[model samples]
Target: MAELSENSSGYGGMKQVFTISLALFIIFLDGSIVNIALPSIIKEYSTDLGMASWIINAYVITVAVFLVFMGKIGDMLGRAKFYNIGLVMFMLSSFFCALSTNVEMLILFRFFQGISGAIVIPTSMGLVRTAVPPEKVGSAMGVWGAVGGLAIAIGPALGGVITEVSDWRWMFYINLPVITIALFLNKRIFQHLREKTQPLHFDVWGTITLSVTLFVLIYTVTKGPDVGWMSWPIIGGFTFSILGVGVFYWIEHKISYPLVDFELFTNKLYVVGLISNLLGGILLAGMMMILPILLTEAMEFTSLQAAYFITPLSAAMLITAPVTGRLIDRFGFFVPMIIGYIISVIGFYLLTSLELNTPTLSILWRIGVIGVGIAMIAVTSLTVSTVSVQSSQSSVASGIFAMVRNVGGAIGVSLFVSVIMTSFNHFSMVSIQDSIQQIHSTSLSTYEKSKLTDALKAQQVSFFDRNYTSHLESLEISKNNLGEWKKMISDLRDQEQKNKVTAIHYAFIFGMLLSIFFSISAMFLLKKSFRL
Candidate 1:
């Protein structure tokens, strides 16, 4: 056993690393893969979109809420033990999720899946820390990140294909095989990889406050559009989120071992990275949500074709992520991050220029540029955030960073939708008003006015004739037509509204610029840390 550490026997730490990474892959893939299959799920279960929609949000909310507390639990209990428990629960929940005949059962099982994910994700990394030698931790982390990234990159495409060939349920079925393999390998290899258990003291108040805060916050953003934001329920949600957050902070300050160490934000690296995560994720997610909508609505692409546009972006990201990861490990964070943000800004600029006539080839390349930018941001931001913290603190740091990113995504989706709607209304009103004014000015011929009076069945007033019936008739016709035109204009406005919302793809352009701005700012902060 002593010689096991010294002897360069068959990759001593590789199995454990792979096991943890495999678990990550399953969790992340399940997170996103099910998205493509959601419509099918709704149809299969004969459920309303509203209720069936909880499948995804329930999982996301549960994962986000419980992550910090679970991470802390891993620290207290054995990391591997928590991870294994999570794995078993996740697998069981997946089975239940598969067996679900209705929306409510699926949502219930999904909550369990989220709890399992919360446990698995953090503890997986924690287990890696315990299994690997100190010197190899960074490399193991890279592998872990890379696998998870690949899983994410592959999920939607894979889900699409599976759903197309078979049915949407296949997406969930796919996880069973992966989980089975993970369970087998975990039993064989990970049995010896447990961390030394510390005195277990789960902070109940901290957990409740933090979880409630996250739930209220995410729930409000997601549901606000459905239920009007100013409605009483939404107002209460916002109130609860604010109060819960305040209480969480207070609890953290007072508790002996808090789920989150709120003071860590004072660290320059942590703060910059957290902010960058938020902003950058907003940009990425905003593009992701809206671009697909644009493709289907305006561009008239099928779901498969719409997803294909993103293939270039995801492909570019897949290739660039590991390289960026290596660069982060070597040259430090600032340079690569700045380059990534700049690249992203250019990508967004290119996307902003998209028009009805934009060619597919050009769209593909533009998206690829954006993908490269995402790759750079993902690696550099994560490196900057996690590397500064000691291993014991990494899980909490990562959890908080993930939370910020998720919230950013939510915020981006909400704000982007709102911006597009606002722009649509503004542009449509301008167009309609201008069209009406143009109609008002062009004087109708006498012949037209005569016909107009007959249509109105009224004595009409005529242009430049005080007593002429033509003018009054013309006014009435104009008024009637104006109302018809208004309706047409409103319909036109709706169409144009959709188009402008499509055109408002420019939000990402603005977001990309914001990303560049923040990335550059992060550079200066990073420089100080590196120089010291």
Candidate 2:
């Protein structure tokens, strides 16, 4: 036992590291892997885009809300104990998620899965800290991060294959085997690994305030485009989010044991990293949410084909992440991060050039560059942020950083969807209006003009509402030649399809601008000296 400390894997620490990493893998793997199946979900449930966003957002927001609190609780209780319990709950919830018959049920199950994830993620860091020797902590952390990167890289492609061959439900089914192995490995390592429990207060008020603030804010954004920005529910959501934030600040300052310690935020590098995380989250999450939709909708790619486009991004990220980690360890944080942001800006710029005519080969490089950019930012920001604070505050620091990233993802989903919906509506309306004007200037009889005008107006309303089948029914459009309106309807649809392509391109441009903004914010990190 005494000689065990001589090696980093004392008392099976190496196995523990992999076990903990397995937990991290499942949570992250589930997030990205499920993304490929989102459109399938929307079609199966016959739900709109906004509700489908919740299938992802519900999980993210729950994890963000509970992560810090769970970390504190793990410290007070036992990190190992909490992690094991979380594993069981996570597995159970995931199973239920596979059985979901409707979107609401799936979202509800995912929320519970998120809660379990909150417990597992932060505690895995703690478990590694306990099991590995002090000198080897950095290497253990690097390995943990590498596993996480691989999960992100593989998730989309794996999900694509699983969803394509079997149903999407099989994707969830796949987790059961992984979970079983993880649980068994955990038992072996944890039996010998001991923890030093501390007395820590879980700040309930702090948790509630911050959680409500993020939930309300994201909810408002998600509902705004569909419900009308100034509608009572949307307005009320914004109001609650604002008040929740104010209350959170007051609670954190007043509470004896705040969930998010105020001292950590004072470190300038840490704050910059947090901001960068938020912006980075927005850029990546928005890109992930919109790109697949654009592929399926505009480019007419099947789910599997769409997954291939994501392959380059994930593949580049997988290769670059560990290399970036080593680079940061050698040269410190700023240079690599700056270069990454620059590459990401260029990557996004290239994405804005996408059109129906762009070849798949061209798209791969554009996606791959962004992946390289993501790897650099991820390694540098995490290193700088965690190193900026004292050892005691490290867990809280990383937890906050991760939580904010999740919040940003939630915000990005809403923001991108909102933008796309609005942009598409504008373009669609313009196309319809132009076509209507063309009919007015035609040589048709007055009665013919009036009849076409009424039909066109009805079609415009149905298109605006996204009720395509209803509009087709009302117009009596059939595969066979129906009437004189056939050519006219075909023209309108062609114009609308063109409008959709343009609008999606606009969303890509929006992401590009945000990527540029993130790159600029990363510059702020160099202004301060980091602990490393």
Candidate 3:
């Protein structure tokens, strides 16, 4: 512990904080960057969307499942040692990911990359907690949150730029240089850190049951929409997850050296912080997934242009996170947290008003407002969760915080996607039915009416596939009703656009409800007058 305390002052402390943050930036960056490049990867490998999606899903599931296990391992062995080892593994995995010849290979390497990230994340927070003085912990956490927020927010933009300028593989190739610099700094800064010198007993069954439980739960959520939610496979997955969780807690209660110490949950502040963190994760992840789709699919912006439009989100978060941390350090977590939720609720309400003709500045400002609120909530919750526990337990606490947030994010993405698609389908069908009746009332020949009806049906089937023109051209309508055909097509296009806007509006309404719930939870659960 002396080695940890000795570096708690002056330039060395700041260097250590930044070094840990640098590694975290890359880990968090990878989580979103690959999403923007998924289409490119799909084209190159000649794979379907379902298969290409695993390139991202595999990494997320792997990270969420292994985070706590790796954190406990770091506690038993040494934080610095595992952190450095993870950096090396990350670099090597990035190399292999970039060099992969097929989608399967890329997914496999991404799983390895996820494992490396799991090893680094919790341990990095633990290192910061132990290395920084107690008073400055909030500020340190703020910096950590800021860097991570900026990385995740900007990842899509950077990926779009890379994919446009060079190739998707460069997304992975770029990690090498960043990791090299982090490794150099890590070795120089923590050279004197020593490992724990005690006999260790690993919790084999607990690890197994917990891992199985998480893997099944997340896998089920990720695939539920693709495969029907009530399908046999999904039902079985839910059943297995429930049983596995029961077994895991039973094992943990009986074990001498459990993977996760149940005592952490006994702390009221910690539990409240986690709940708030989970809600915040749901909002942030869902918005990140949907906003890009809205820009590209509805607004008809290119990927690069969409990325540029969303830049204010990252910028707002980067600027707000550090300041939020300092506020927590001075005034406490509760005030900043409540204020954050209020701002977020306002932002979500603004999002619900988005229209087809909404100006670019309106969209940018709405996103920026949400970003600021998210940054505040995120930094404050994380800082509280970290500071509420004993120093010895910081690594595991960090792991649990991270795992909950990831699970919430997964749920958010799944939920938002389901709502949006279902709503879109319903609205599209209504529009098509109305158009069909209108076509029936027109005084055209029976044959032309039948042709137009068939075209409407075809358009409904392939609405989201973005093949409207091709589908219409394939119908081979007679030139006699060409004017009516063009008019009908134009009306259908306008209705399609409206359906899209209505679907997104409904999604944001859901988001607003979530934001309100988040606010209510923070107000009731958190102490009104507490300070770090």
Candidate 4:
């Protein structure tokens, strides 16, 4: 308890904030930087197109799995100890990632990187508690929040530049300098004080259960589409997850020092803030991940061009976070949060209506509006949730908050990808069917019909004919003269199928609409606590 108290706040606390926040920025930068380079990675690995996705999903799953455990670890070991270890691990993993020669190698390294990230993220927040006084905790947290937002905004652009100028590896290489600086500061000026004199007894069962449950749950959701959703693997995975959660909840309640204290949910603000973080993460992360891919693949922009178009959205987030933090500090989180959601609704509505030919500048401007709105709601909602908790529980509260955000991001990506796959598959199937029908109806000079009939017969046992082979051969020859016509039909239908992807973009629009609902709910819940 003394260690927790000492870490909570004082003059030494102020200096620690910059060191820890900078460390956190490096970890988060790893997250966002990879998004832009995913396309290039796909090309280099020559793997499944969707394999680019696992780079993100794997990283998210690893981080989400360890957050609660690491949060508990911070309570046991000193924050600075795990903080430095996580940093070293993250830096080492990044170096290996930069040297990776294959997709499998890259993913393995990325997983280790995520474990380090999980360690750094929660402890950074715990360190903040030690650094700032209670009255100004929100404001100090705001600054920490701003660093995260800036990294999110800049990460893609920086990754794009690195990918374009050299290769995708430089994005990881870029972390070394930042890590070096943070290490020096940490070693030279930071002091470590053990928090609890009593030997910390970890709830071993609770930790394993929670970690297993999250991993299985996320893995099931992510792979459900590729593997049959009802297949044994998915079903078994989900079953394990449910069992894990039930057991985890029971163990947590029974243990003297629970991994996550269930009592925290009794506070309305914590509940609301947690749920809001979830929905907000889904909204923001889905957009960031999908829009760039759409720009490059669906719209035919080059990687750099797509990155340029995304710049304004990141800019909007960067510009508004600090301002929103100040406003939340002064007036509370409700009104501004409500306004932000309303603005986001408008921006998403605009996004849904975009066409294939929509100008690049126009898209940027609309996304910027949405970005500003997100910044307003995101930081304040996070701040309000933490502030609502007693000082003693703040570290735990922040851990849960971060975990929600990570889970939400993973779910959001999985959901959006599922949407894209369904849309693309439907469009392809429909286009093919329509073309086949049109070919059947053509006045193919009798020759064309006979030719197609024989071709179909050769392709399928159902259409095979024994006696008509000679007659069909002649017909096939005549039809062969009209080959250009078949080519024309294929090209037309392919274009139409491509057009259907635009409609799929509206799925994202619906996702933002969900964000609106979340915002409204937050307003209803937080209205009574506006003073905070």
Top candidate, metric TM-score: 3
Cα-lDDT of candidate 1? 0.69
Instruction: Tell me the RMSD of model 4 versus the true structure.
Output: 5.9
- Candidate 3 lDDT tens digits, 125-232: 888776667778888989988988898889899999999999999999999999999999988988766555345568899988888899989989878867878899
Q: What TM-score quantifies how close candidate 1 is to the native fold?
A: 0.83
2 or 3, which is superior by lDDT? 3
Once model 4 is optimally superposed onto the true structure by TM-score, how far is the C-alpha of residue 319 displaced, in angstroms?
Answer: 1.0
Rank order (by lDDT, best first): 3, 2, 4, 1
lDDT of each: 0.69, 0.73, 0.84, 0.73
Question: How well does each candidate superpose onto the true structure, as a TM-score?
Answer: 0.83, 0.86, 0.95, 0.85
Name the weakest run of 10 consecutive residues (lDDT summed) in model 2: 1-10
Residue-level lDDT of model 4, residues 418-490, one tens digit each, is 6666666565555545555666776565656555654534432110122222332334244455565546444
> Residue-wise lDDT of candidate 2 within 1-532, one digit each (tens)?
0011223345456667777887788888877788777778899999998788788777877888787777667656676787888889999999999999999999999999889988887777656654555444444555666666567666777888987888998877777888889888888776655555566567887887887787778767766767888899988999998888888889999977788778787787888778776776676677777777777777768778887788787777767766776666666667777887788777777877887779889988888887888667765666566556654565566678778777787778778877787888888777777867887886666766676677666654332333442454354433343454556666776676666677777777787777777777667756664324
The model with the greatest lDDT is: 3
**Residue ranges of candidate 4 with Cα displaced over 4 Å:** 1-18, 36-55, 101-105, 133-136, 187-198, 228-232, 432-442, 446-500
Overall local distance difference test of candidate 2:
0.73
Better candidate number, 3 or 4, judged by TM-score = 3
Show the lowest summed lDDT stretch of 10 residues, model 4: 460-469
Q: Which pairs clash (backbone N, Cα, C closer than 3 Å) in model 3?
A: none
Score candidate 3 by lDDT. 0.84
lDDT of candidate 1 at residue 209, scale 0 to 100 = 79
- Cα lDDT of candidate 4 equals 0.73
